[model samples]
Target: MTLPRIAIDAMGGDEGVRTIVAGVALARRRHEGLRFILFGDEAQIQDALGHHPNLSRAAEIVHTDRVVAATDKPSQAIRQSRGSSMGLAIQAVKNGDAMAAVSAGNTGALMAMAKLALRTLPGIDRPALAAFLPTLGDNDVVMLDLGANTECDARNLVQFAIMGAAYARVVLDLETPRVRLLNIGTEELKGTDEIRDAAAFLRTASGLPLRFDGFIEGDRIGSGDADVIVSEGFAGNIALKTAEGTARFVTDVLRRAFTSSLRSKAGFLLSKPALHLLKVHLDPNNHNGAVFLGLNGMVVKSHGGADEKGIANAVHVAARLVEADLAARIAGDMARVGPILSEEMIAK
Candidate 1:
């Protein structure tokens, strides 16, 4: 079988083609059979490739003069960006030229371009952004709707659950991932109607390849309360951002405390290896890809400011999803829950 190639938007990130090309080199080293289709300015890409001899052979560049701006709104981006690097990269996935597409551009813009070009899956109403979150357990937790679909209905929530669970199966290597809804309380009657309704649907729904472990409050997210936590984009984005901020805050505090005195500095040197491990476990660069799930083709959104390691991690994620055939898994899961969704709609 032929190995899948990943299409990259080389002009999409904060640092431009330099960082992206370096990441391409890193990904090439990690995955020997990987190939890349990069979209950006031919001159700039050529210049950037000079430093990475191996990547130049594995990558094929498609040049476009225009680049999507980070400040561009989703509507404006879609309207004006057909020939832009980001749009062309996503179109590659839509056209079957690439197995998956990766970009570090504007979140709304990438989602818009992907949806406009590739559309949603059979039973999925909308695509949700999903990412891995470091947890107290050995395996990382998967969370969804990080910044897509600010408002979602019960059906959307259920669909997110299905997609998140399928994602967890591949990313976390689980036989049956424990799925949970992010809610105010764990009580049966707590949370909004949609939350309650989604919970009820999962409880009675059969044939899906996940274990619905009821509602989980925000406090338990870092503790690995569930393998997959599903939420609407509004709340999910807030949770994601808050957790990021708290992680930074703790790191900053630790840095300051360890440097405040000579004794503390000596202690820090003594614990350098353990602290390095802690940093690796908490680093966002190690988990830099946010997948736009429910699309017909795979679309991964990398952090705009991500460095080479982060971008390489994002590429790894896209490659893994392609290998796992995420869309097929979603379809299989969706088919099982069809009757439950229809019955609930009829009851409503």
Candidate 2:
């Protein structure tokens, strides 16, 4: 199958042109059909392209020395976006120059530009930052609203559930993903008014392609009980950071325990293979894409510190979503239950 072209913000990440070029080169090697349009400094992009003849042939560069700084606020960056690599790349999506855009730049800036350029899909109040989280189940869980909007009402939470479930179906290949709201407790009376209202709305809705599994506590996030977890930006961001911190803590503790004594060192050697597997599973690079769902066009956010492997994974995610027509899937699901959701929200 022919894949859609992706526009790359070549000067956005920590290593800028070098990292983006190297990652695109690696991705093209694995998927020869992948195409890219690079936006950055002409000389630097050309210099990096010299190392990968295949990518040089597949990519087209649009030179611009301008870049969005790591410290630039979203509001400030959006005004200067016309000349920056991040801005131009997102514009390519809006202009149909590329089907999707990818960047490892300032997360706030990228989100701001994409939302402004691409706008939100019909029935979507705001876009949510969604990503896959490693779980103990057969597949990873999809979590949403990770720092996009600090505060959200019942309507936003319900919309997040619809968008998150659509994302899970495309990425995880689940037909009817089980979804739950992140809350203080699992009981019916657990969370705040917004959470309960959203849950109540979802339960009464008849036509969405998701299974409403009620509330899921923060501790149960990694248990794989729900395919999609929804929360307001404030709580979602905290839950995401806590999970990441816990992963690092476990790995650090294991490392220290394995080196405490000669006997422990020997034990570590005996369990080398198992430990290696665990390390790979916990590596953030292996799961590097965070998508801005509810957008009219596709935009993927790669980790700013990601290496070639991480960048490649992010590109792969963009490709998968484009191939699955995620926007249309989301729109269709919303249409199916739009009336029911509106009526329920009004009744409350």
Candidate 3:
């Protein structure tokens, strides 16, 4: 079996080297043929792996002297920190040293470095962050532009829809996945003129092989209204964070309710297993990463606060996407979209 090599930014996230090293170990144990190139300070990584005999032999490390801080501006970080761990990790993917790159560092910096190093596909203008949201129903939904591009035009939204639909088809194995634009309401005139115009474009677009499901409101996200939801980065980020906050609030309320009294505690004991299962299912950590779609290679962004388990899950997600041949599929799908606007049209 050919093992997939993933480059992990070992110096990223709050847990730093420990979380990344542990995640690599977990990924290797879970997937037989998954290999990793851990990028960071060589001494720290070696020290972290020193106690883990099982993981010491299975992974390789690339040493870097600098690290990109979460607070650094994306453009400046990429420019000034050329030899930083994050930059080096992305470079590994560009050099074909790895199949995918995973990082829990500053998202903007990662995007900038990735775009600078790997570049986008032929027809893609900007890469969007695509994430999976588990719905109440059977099928999951893919939301895009989750804070990658704060302001997007009508054409950008349409492109996001196309890229998201392609992701659903290839990564989620959904044939003819339903695509919907995230809007304020389901009514035709609910959102801005941009959304209205984008809707028109999607309706007439012939090349994208997807089931365009019109508009989907923010409230309907968890209701399973569509298989893929498209939105600008600002709105998408708000929607995602809103959902996460609500989930946390509900869990906390439930915990307090269950511990109120002896009888309640007894009831909680009986319900502990089910609650644990639910928590695992709904925990953001289990689904804490987003893939920067439309790029030449796979790049997954882990939450900066992610722990060992969360980091492991992000790696798992990246490995699964690589195994599914997501990048090639996206390239093929974009190819099928035919000739986009020429440089002149774009300049206009």
Candidate 4:
């Protein structure tokens, strides 16, 4: 088996070079064939990796003098920080020097950099971010457009559904993943005019192999009614944050209840395993990264505050995506779906 070469932005995130270097070392241990190209100032990366003997021989560093600040605007960063670590890392993937790129920088900056470098697929209008959510059911659910493009048209939603379905099939190993358009209500007449029109397009569309389950209510996201959920970036981002907040609130409440009294503390000891399981299921760190779908190459966006373990998981996700040939599978699925709207329109 050929080893997957991953380009990582070592200057990204709050923890800076230290956590990024630690994450790379961790991932390298778990995945023997994984080769990494760390993009950042050579001195900083060397300083961080000096403590880890294993990483010295396992990874290579690609030096970049510039760095994109978290506060920098996406467009501005892409333009001004052309030589930044994040930008150069993405460029490596675009130039075929690396199979995938992982970054823990500003979400907008990462998205803009990737768009400018890798570009979207042949028929994709705009690429979107796809994040995994743990459902109440046995299988995990995929939610998309996680603040990639704030606005989307009916055709864009349809494209998201198709791309999302293909992603679930390849990544989640679902044969006939059920896809649903995220909406306030399940009724066809509900939501904006664009959504109604998009729903109609999906209904009459042909050759999209997966099961289209129509509109899904926001409340049913954790209910596991569908394997894949599609929505515009603005709405998807709100939904993802809301779920995270709810999970945190629930955990806090449980913690308070478990420590209120001596008896409660004793009971909590007995329930520690169950609580650990719940925390694992709801923790954002466990699902810290989102994939930039519809791009020609695999790009993963890690949380800006990601720690060593979180960054490691993001790299793991990127490695799996490359191994699974996710981008090629998505392109094949789009080709099979054909063009619902004008080919020229989407290409533009």
Instruction: Please identify model 3 stretches exceeding 4 Å from their true place.
Output: 340-348
Model 2's alpha-carbon lDDT is 0.90
- Work out candidate 3's RMSD over C-alphas: 2.2
Report the C-alpha lDDT of model 1 over 3-47, residue by residue, as the tens digit. 678999999989789999998789889777778999999999999
Which ranges in model 1 have alpha carbons more than 4 Å from their true place? none
**Residue 48's lDDT in candidate 3:** 89
Ranking the candidates on lDDT from highest down gives 1, 2, 4, 3
Ranking by TM-score: 1, 2, 4, 3
Error of 2 at 323 (Å): 1.4
lDDT per residue (tens digit) for residues 1-348 in model 3: 656799989998888797789877877777767778888999999998986667777688999989999899997897899888899889889999899999999999999999989999877889999999989878778999899999988878877887898888876788898999999888888898878877877776665679887999888998887889999999999999999999899999999999899999999999989999989988888887799998999999999998788888889888888888889988888787736433322443
Q: Which scores higher on lDDT, 1 or 3? A: 1
Quantify how close model 2 is to the true structure by its C-alpha RMSD in Å.
1.4
Candidate 2 lDDT over 1-348, as tens digits, reads 545689999998896678889998988776677689999999999999999999999899999988999999999998876789999999999998888899999999998889999999878889999999999999999999999899999999999999999999888999999999999988999889999989988998888889999999999898999999999998998998887888999999999999999999999999999999988998898988899999988999998899988998888888888778888888887787777777778888
Instruction: Tell me how far the alpha carbon of residue 10 in candidate 2 is from the true structure, in angstroms, after superposition.
Output: 0.9
Which digits, one per residue and each the tens of the lDDT, describe model 4 over residues 58-106? Answer: 7899898899998999888977999999999999999998999999988
